[model samples]
Target: MQGAQRNSLRLLQWMMAASLALPIALFVFASTISYTSTNDIADREIERTLDVAHEHALKVFETIDRSLAEINEVVRGLPDDAIRAREPALHQRLKRLTDSLPQLKSAWIFDADGRSLVNSLVSPPPEQGFADRDYFLAHVDHSIGTFIGTPLTPRPPYQGARFFGVSRRRDSDDGRFIGVIQASVLPEYFESFYARIGSDPGSFFAIGRTDGTVLAHFPRLDRDLRLDPTGPVGQKIAAHPDHGLMTIDWASDGIERRIGYRRVAEYPIYVSAGLETSAIRARWYATIGQHLVFGVPATALLFLLLAFAFRRTQHLQAEAAARREAEEALKHSQRLEALGQLTGGVAHDFNNLLTVIRASVDLLNRPQLTEERRQRYVTAIADAVARAAKLTSQLLAFARRQTLKPEVFDVGERIRSLHDMLATLLGSAIEIAIRLPAEPCLVNADAGQFETALINMATNARDAMQGKGRITFAVQVATTVPDTLTHLVGSHGFVSVAVSDTGIGIPAARLGRIFEPFFTTKQVGHGTGLGLSQVFGFARQSGGEVTVMSEVGQGSTFSLYLPRVPPDLLPQRQAPNTAPALAGSGMSVLVVEDNIELANFAADGLTELGYSITLVDNATDALAELVVDADRFDVVFSDVVMPGMTGLDLAHAIGDRGIGVPVVLTTGYSEALAQEGRLGFELVQKPYSIEELSQVLYRAARLRRVRDGAAE
Candidate 1:
């Protein structure tokens, strides 16, 4: 009887071990399948989103091209004799052309002398000469059938309406040039398309110029919320054009977002869409939770039944628990990664604010400060600001929150400008030599921030040199080496800016963490430990890489590898024009601002500057005031972002009521308002001193005078 009992127990133990092992194995298999399926689905969804965005952008370009073609056909309809005579028949033909196309806001003919022969709209004669305009000059050589002009805000009197003109040379049957017929399209035509994109409530889309200026956005939010594409992420995109999607912690939104960006293949613009990753993961989490609720109980019951049958099941149970723990560890690692990104974002924003304050305080110390008492106050304020700036910089570097504005500039010129300052900044113990090409050795970088990065690197080099050593700075076009070859395949371009110092070189072990924030080798109070980190951030933000080469006794070299901007596509430099003076005395102005302090300050400043001011806190009150006496105010000075009604809506209202009062918009934010393209009014930026307000007022007054003179 004893032998039979032992045999039964042995059989049961074997059965129990198999029971526990089977379910755990199945659970692992299920999880693997789920993860793989989910990953594939996510990738497909991302691709689809990118494809849709690309299609939408292409449509916009096509529409603009078609409109230009239509304008060309209209210009060809004008008779050669009518063009030469500049007769009423020509005016009628232009009017008919504009009337037929709703998209064409206004059409006009300008003679070779820049005289407006005929205009679709009434009231103004050709007093302002267009001969000096870029469009006019561009047409002198390429007077083709349809020449598309660059985007520009039309001058005042037209209230700075943003329009791109399409000009065509009028020719006779003999193919001789007669005159030019131009059609101008209002910015509204392009803006209307953005509205139709149907934006998600929490998500926003922005189209920005290459320089970080926003062109358009859906569900218009605060202008201050506009993302600077020239910031760090933007530089990354420019440097690695093929990096289709990236997840970045965006400080403005206080969240990590999966950003999808694509450069418009045919234009100098970029389109980016961001979706909050947390929001996306929330749905995934809910789905997983439901699965686990069912999975956990079923899994537990199977294990419990197996334990009753088997005494040897403990070992198998341990293995299953280990696998689950490993999976949890992987999840925890992902969470930590996300946390690091969040910290970095916070640091970037804090640093930007600090930089602004530091620059402002520095400006206060200029000789422009005349009074001794005022200067003393400014100095005290500067001291406080400097301390605050230092604290924020430390926080930023620790969090890795530095964004950059990158541009292509001559490295030689950039260094020479700071030569004198560097000598003063560093003692005579350190010798600095700059070796640069005579011709412009251009590297894509932000001039201001690049200077700061260079200074930080130089300071580090000086410190390492122990107050006596030579530092050499060199600029050159990048060349590929076998071991250090970059992944920028098919590209024949790059620029390298290098700084080398004969100092105590970094040890091999410490070199890797040198770019990390708050990682310093110096004693306390000697450094904030942000110097190298700032250089790293600056390099990354400029869409480049920062690399270090060091040896114990041979010293160290730091190289910043940046992309090069093509020569033909470089930004054009336009000569500055003096601000025109106000042409009227005793002109009454209506000031609208939501901020009471700002409004009152503006009113006081304008009143002192010779204009009578009527101040209102909102657009509604301003409109009510206007209705009471529409003719009282000569111009409406309003803020764009307000509580009830926006400045643009107010301007539209005034236009509908036939109030010919000119509108002057004032805002601290320029991106959104600028994108609106000359809302038929002049715009002045906020935080303006009294002098700037006076100048803008003067310009508005002068514009009215010019318009009135033309009317007479």
Candidate 2:
């Protein structure tokens, strides 16, 4: 009886472990995936956000180009004498032109001698001719197109303002040296407009000549300021004068920024929209934080579940030690039965995780995981685990025993939102069409399971089509149930999400058993045969049913029919947590363990991973160390089963005194520690390999970072 009970427990434990590890492992991989994809999303977001500024700058320059063209046309027709005779008329025209474009500070015509013939603000031209001005000198020497000059002090009637010139050189019919047409634009106007684009203090916008002359800028400085035209950014703009986007080293402020730039079609001016490097990555860091919050606990808990399952066997083995050992043949027979019961995707994913975990652990054994990679994988696994858990909720979910988290959602809108992801997922070879209704078809279901089913269906379609074809997702309302939808028995007023693919159709004979567990027509390791079953299970659980319509050599359509909710019901969306990353930047750790070997292992791992470590033999010594210098370490890593005041006691003592550093306790098995319960410290189980050691250390370090951040 004892032997049979032990064997049964082993079988059950392995089954539970298989259930636990697969989901968490899947999440770790998803988290690993975010390392590449989220950064890609962040890059795309940066471009999209900066484009707002780009469009604004583009419009500003276009306005300048038009003003330049109109001024040139007027100056070209009227020679110096023509303007002198109708000076009042020309000033009125110039004033009207300035009124049309707010960026223009003043508009005027200057002769070859650089004396203003007529000015927009003053009817009589200012005596201060711009002969010394760069634009005036360049036109005199016969420059053409547009010359964007350095900002100048506002002369005479426009005394309080500063202005930059957009001037064009006009000549006689025979091309003799003539006067220059100029529009002096207010940088403040552009600055005020750019302010509407973003409120982040560090994000600034600028438009300048390709030669590096600042035409306009935001955060309006009261004093005169002009950037070095030949500086790093100026040279970059010069190199790609037509238009470009790049990372630039700002010469004036020396701050690095990611810039999106484009040259105004008909002007020498180039517009640049830029955000600081930190500002651009702010979203990406938030994405990472959201992933870590869920992922870390999931990864750690996954290990704990496996530990629970295994430790039961260990406990039984200790009790059975005094009794006769089980026969190898019997043990082999039990494993085979368990193996047969849990084959396909669950096992496959479990194996994949072990492989990755083993690889990561081996690296830790070598103690070579750098701080960045260490933090990434740790956070990734934690984040990814959550999704993986949702993916594998098959058995009890299908049995209808599990509670449904039914929320009303629009099938049509959901399908539309998935367009980009579906495109990227299917790749270029496969075309994806999202056929969503103008009206939303609301349904009640667990959003995660619903999404998972759709993803699985898409994956199945991809494999069936051999990765090259069209996959269409369509949503519609079904007013009546059909005789063929017997499995969906009571579903009424249904909303359907139909996924159709132009792939080789499923054989009629195989269709009947397609939803059965472990049944697959594909080669080993390719199809788990759980895809259709999940769809079927999810449909039934959501008070709906799945329908399959296919023909040989023709495409296949799998429709998920879910009961429709009233139009009055609102849909829910999950917002990602945008928190700062828990960064471990050379924090000191206190390692307390009774065992010399374990203490050495902990200290060595922490030290090699770039953390300063102080090791003590017992919790007594740990308390002394902390009492002597409370601020000595950022995190305290203690062994729970230590002699003379356990790690829990040290934690409680720390809590009482409010020593403040986060306590991390490592253990193998302790009834006492478990009973102590909720020590307000992180738990890391013992007999840890290098991989396990690193995970706990990362946890401690992460907690310390969080604590320190709160303090700050």
Candidate 3:
């Protein structure tokens, strides 16, 4: 019966999986067909574009030939000595030719020696010589025939002007070559025409000489129109001579192009049209992408419905089982809740008394006390502080009011930095070994809480070892998380940290309750039993997990798993410096607090740091002082909660007045501050040491400079 049930489950899973896979397989097949068809269509597009270019190029050459014939007839019909005898008539005819053909620049008649005899311009002819010109040489060599020459640059404003020339060799009655009749062809006319030819921005047309000197190209400026016959585009052109269609990257921009070209057999000119490969591919892919956008989801939905229909009965059974498990979990949670209720009340009451003891101890450990008494008192106070820290950590587990200031940092680097401090805390009696991966395993969490959790786990390992064994901390990445911690670590990725200790491990029975608040295996006075509980609370709060595995004789391993944060998203870490602090340089500070003692303490600290201070007890008084003398203070240090108005309200009021004074808000977890979670002004957490205050003061001053736009 069990085997049959297992087989049935397997069959159902296979059916569900097949239903899911079918749509994906269909999509893959459809995508292949779509892409192949798109590519074929793209090739047809390129061919059609090339055909248009070819027709344009044919018209260009035919127009040039027809224009050459017209000029030749006009020149031949005139008298042999017409230039000298009737220069105006010859010039008028030349001008007429230029007027009819906009591409035609100007016409000139050159003497046998190639000096300008007559030109189309009415103005005086400049003393120009074109004896060395290619058109002049070509015409002189060809008797009684018109010839086309390579493109050349004329003088300004036509200087560096790319134009071809048609020259008809003037022959005497004996058929001897006389001075050439030349007409300049401006390639700009072809360029402008080609610019209007295609819709694709990347597609371009070009007219080049047989030797590969470009006469003109549209959609780009190519001053040096020379193409290297050795290059990819040049070689591709060379390989396909008559009417070629090939793909190659043009050297100018190195963009792959599907080029169609036609070699002008009647002349040295050739025309090329290049369609960008990327543009063609984009058109192809966009069609397929559009199909996938609508088709894929529809296909997936159909398969999903089929799978769900088939699995409905099994899903109902699973839901019934889950409800039963949830009831059992609720009862188990009630028992844990009862235990936590008693523990929480005791921890909360003890916290208040411990705060008084901590304050009294701080006042007692002064210079007035003898060195011997001070040492004894400090040691006793340190022990009590440790105990109090443990008790508070345990109470924090049940407290929903704890707000985390989460930041992303490398867990490996952070742990490595804590090495020296952990060593001092653990002492030389125990060995500490650190093993970290090559790269940082970044995680997002409150850095202070993370370090505290590490210390707590280390402290437990030390006690378990009787203060004399090795502890190892290893950092790595976890591909999968356990079911117990699935919700905490989440799905993106995670950093795994293993804290192993070579110590006398806990018995299996006691291991289950180790993370419970105040559940200690040690005797009274040894521990408050909150170390592991704090670690558990910290891990859960940080959107991570903490778990333990122990063997009685062997050792124990506590693993902390944190969700990985990308390096780019990691927040900047700022820590206070312990070096000689920067003094305030006679700056003025306004200290505001509802409590007189706290205000005085803050004022004294600023004064000692070389800042002059004015104290105000409450936001109402501070505002009154500021309104009276706004320029007196360089910085404002205000406590968050005040009787009349909060510091946030005061800051807003200051903004309204446009006083532009920098305000720093201090708070010790009040409902006012806690509700907002973060303050508008620069913040320094409460109960901060003098060093931390100094650093924050510097930051506040820097922020003031920035706000005032006076930053250097």
Residue 466, candidate 2: C-alpha displacement in angstroms: 78
Candidate 3 lDDT score relative to the true structure = 0.75
Most accurate candidate by TM-score: 3
As for TM-score, the candidate ahead, 2 or 3, is 3
Worst 10 residues of 3 by lDDT: 394-403
Q: lDDT of all the models against the reference?
A: 0.65, 0.73, 0.75
Candidate 3 residue lDDT tens string, 1-712: 4466457667767766776677678778877887788667766776686677667766766776676666666666455467567677767877887888787788778878887777776534566778998888976776635566767878643354577777777776677776787888888887887788766757777888777777777765756567877776677766776777777777567778777788765666678886788887787678778877987787677667756764774676567568768977997897788578556646654765577567658767566887777667667666665555445544564242334566788889999999999999998999999999997788887787789789989999998899998999999998767677666554457888999999999899987788876677777657666677778887776667788989997889999988888756655675643545658888888888888877777778767989888887878888888899888778888887777798888888888888868888876545554445555567776655566676677778767778677644
When 2 and 3 are scored with lDDT, the better candidate is 3
Name model 2 segments beyond 4 Å from true. 1-32, 46-59, 68-85, 199-204, 218-241, 305-712
lDDT of 2 by residue, 1-712 (tens): 6777678777767766666677668767876676567556545655675567667766866677687787677667676788889899889998998898887878878888888998888888767677788778878876666777888887655575677887888788888777787888788787888788757545767777766667676555555545666776667766877766678766557677777777766666666666777765675567767876987787677768767867776777666754535555666886676467456457676676666666665555556668888876666554445334443455435544333445678888777777788778877899988887777788878776788788889988998899999998888777656565655544347787889999999989978877766567888867666677778887876667888888888989998888887777789875342322332357788888888987887667666667788888888888888999978787888887767798888999998887877887776555564334444567664444455555656776676778788979
TM-score of each: 0.37, 0.39, 0.45
Clash totals for all models, in order? 5, 7, 0
Instruction: Give candidate 3's error at residue 156 in angstroms.
Output: 99
The alpha-carbon deviation from the true structure for residue 328 of candidate 3, after best TM-score superposition, in angstroms, is 14
- Model 1, range 533-622, lDDT digits (tens) per residue? 777766655556778999987889998776677644454332233343343367898888888988888777677657888888889999
Clashing pairs in 2: 27-384, 27-385, 28-381, 295-382, 295-383, 296-382, 667-686
